[model samples]
Target: MRFEIQFSGHENIRSNHQKTIEITKESHLTPQGDCIVGVNASASCADLPRELKDKLKNSDSKITFSISVENYEFIIKGNGHQDLILTHEEDIVIRKSDFICPRTLAVKCDKASDLLPREMVELLRNPNTKGVFSITID
Candidate 1:
């Protein structure tokens, strides 16, 4: 199954955090939010589809998410867990660690914001740039 989130880029998108990748519902960005790749997000953790959230709570579920913008694409793979609450209201986060939080979408992710290509990070710095974060579960 699949779910997609639409979001826009921001000039302050640093994409330099070593452990996490994030998108937020806030329209504004600050350089200190180094993990946030997009803002004005279409969905927060609590806003995810019920079916998708259910699957994401299963320990056996495998999740893949593609962060696509313009001509660039970054893929992240992670496993779901029974511990996931998936109910944060303002943000969606992908973590390279096994941390579980309401804002986390996938844990043990293969990539964090710092791993994103510099070219892609540059594009993500444009406030007008649009992105699609699509997730598939199996």
Candidate 2:
């Protein structure tokens, strides 16, 4: 079976590099048996919860993730830095001490379907609508 996600929000957040951040895409199946999507956490540091910050700072930390969007949420039981891939087509080596600012997080999917709704795919392809997508898991 396949999972579908819808991302949408107009809130502007800045990254550590001072770039405007936004949610770019809804989650979708990848060739590597994973579901990947982008999130712009530019303003994350300013309001990041202390507990979450501590978890991210720890090298041995494994934090659980529950991303809620629309009427559904995906529960991921691990550190995003360790569990997700940074890119869709390439495997890059990331240092354990490396930090993830505002970026995409890839969630592994077992037997995830490659198909996606045509409309959703079109939205993803549109550059103008890049940062307001939200999610709904199926």
Per-residue alpha-carbon lDDT of candidate 1 for residues 4-64, written as tens digits (9 for 90 to 100): 9999999899999999999999998878999999999999999998999999999899999
Count of residue pairs whose backbone atoms collide, per candidate: 0, 13
Give the alpha-carbon lDDT of every model.
0.92, 0.30
Question: Over 4 Å off in model 1, which ranges?
Answer: none
Model 2 misplaced stretches (Cα beyond 4 Å): 1-43, 80-138
Instruction: Write candidate 2's Cα lDDT for 1-138 as tens digits.
Output: 122223432222111111111233333323332223333312222233444444444445444434343343334433334433233222111112233533333222111112323334334343333332222122
Best-matching candidate per lDDT: 1
Question: Largest TM-score belongs to which candidate?
Answer: 1
Q: How much does candidate 2 score in TM-score?
A: 0.32
